[model samples]
Target: MSNYKPIDAKREEFRKYLEHAGVMDALTKVLVSLYEETEKPEDALEYVRKHLGGITESSSNTDALRKELDESQAQVTELKAKLAKFETEAGNE
Candidate 1:
């Protein structure tokens, strides 16, 4: 019976952590939105996935990031080439 106190404290601490992290609020909002829906979605899990910000949205963002990465790489290569050219000219002088 005495051992139960530590377990209860640990559970409460975890609950507080989740609340501080905004997880509890996000969940409450998602649940409220789900409850408020008029025509219930057939696949509840999919609905939850969409409400929580779907993976598809992030995947779409990858395309733009990849383009930026490629452009940055090209810029780095151009700068390195210029640096090498300047160093070679300085050495000759």
Candidate 2:
């Protein structure tokens, strides 16, 4: 059986984040140029590994970034919920 798997959905999500964050477009341009010059996928991958090590260093960093953003959003949501609760309590008081 073929063992190929599709790209991770998270990768696309992160790629979108990078694009919005102004990293994906730059990486795409660099990787495309390298691919054209080398005519080799491995070479282009190596170029990305070396040149864009910031994003590829570890999954932890990616997870941490994602988690951090999520936590910040959660905090905002929790604060809003608490504020509403407090407002209700004060109204009752």
Indicate which candidate wins on lDDT: 1
Candidate 1 segments whose C-alpha is farther than 4 A from its true place: 1-7, 54-93
Tens-digit per-residue lDDT, 1-93, candidate 1 = 455545588899999999998888887888889999999999988888777774236756877889999999999999999999999999999
lDDT of 2 by residue, 1-93 (tens): 899988799988987898898787768866776667745565656777755765445767878999999999999999999999999999998
For model 2, the superposed segments whose C-alpha errors exceed 4 Å read 1-33, 36-60
Weakest lDDT window of 10 consecutive positions for candidate 2:
35-44
Judge candidate 2 at residue 86 and give its lDDT.
Answer: 98
**Ten-residue region with minimum lDDT total, candidate 1:** 51-60
In candidate 1, the residue pairs with backbone N, CA or C atoms under 3 Å apart (3 or more residues apart, or in different chains) clash, namely none
Listed in order, each prediction's TM-score against the native is 0.53, 0.39
User: Each candidate: RMSD to true structure?
Assistant: 6.1, 13.0
Give the Å error, residue 1, model 2. Answer: 64
